[model samples]
Target: MSNLVTMTIASEAFLLLSFIIIILSTKNPKRNVLWVILFIIGAAPHLYLAIDHVTNDYMDANIGLGLAFMFTWVYSVAAFIIAIILLVKKKRDNNISQEQ
Candidate 1:
């Protein structure tokens, strides 16, 4: 991809992430949206490009595999951590509300 496209994608990612953060901040008690969005935005493009590169033989197979593995692992682990935290927060919120 060209530098312009890369920059545009990065800009879009930041804008979208910020927008989602704003929305979730007000409405979501546990803030699950940002994490999920982070995973999707962070992983999908690299995975897609990696797959494309592998299929088209545009890059070395090991490099493509590395990119895929790194993104998949990092994003998935982050999302899972987010989920766990959200669950904990929800449990706490429920306990507090019930105690009132």
Candidate 2:
């Protein structure tokens, strides 16, 4: 009912959809599952904040929230870096296999 609830649901749904897409599109489903898990862990704080907002209807600009946001940002950056590494490794492996 609240905007926070709606946003949280939408974010979680989007993450689920992303996980599905990663699993379907990748040759390595197991590895993608790990990625999804990492993403879920990274998003846990945001999820908690959303639930807090819904139940308490109180949004506090506190240090904990700031830390959570920072952690989320760090996770996002880490994910992006890891993705790039994986892509490069995959491409190199493909090239090597092709040459052989």
Candidate 3:
């Protein structure tokens, strides 16, 4: 209906897609890094916005939340958590594989 709505939907879609890629890539050690990269891609925007929001001060900030901004933060945090989990799992899997 509007540009903001479209962007919000796209951001959510990215989060979902990256999450699935990360989960599937976990089984392939070589692809695990790709998955983490996708995860960072997903997190980058929100993290950028969140950091900007803080650094610029919410009042002077150019990006207008208007509303629905909370979801961006939520998505960013979720992406970050997923990335950390994937990294830890990858490392653990590497250790186990090496022992054999």
Best candidate, lDDT-wise? 2
User: Please, what is the whole-model Cα lDDT of each candidate in the order they appear?
Assistant: 0.55, 0.63, 0.62
- In candidate 2, which residue ranges exceed 4 Å CA deviation? 1-27, 54-60
Query: Candidate 2: deviation at residue 65, Å?
Result: 1.7
Q: Candidate 1: lDDT over CA atoms?
A: 0.55
Worst 10 residues of 2 by lDDT: 16-25
* Ordering by lDDT: 2, 3, 1
Q: Write the per-residue lDDT of candidate 2 for residues 1-100, one digit (tens) a residue.
A: 4654665566555555544544544577668768677777978987786566556644545456456656665655655555556667777888999999
Candidate 3: lDDT of 17?
68
Show how many residue pairs clash in every candidate, following the order shown: 0, 0, 0
lDDT of 3: 0.62
- The residue ranges of model 1 lying beyond 4 angstroms of the native Cα positions read 1-37, 58-60
For each candidate in turn, the TM-score is 0.53, 0.62, 0.39
Instruction: Give me the displacement of residue 68 in model 1, in angstroms.
Output: 2.9
The local lDDT score (0 to 100) that residue 58 gets in candidate 1 is 49
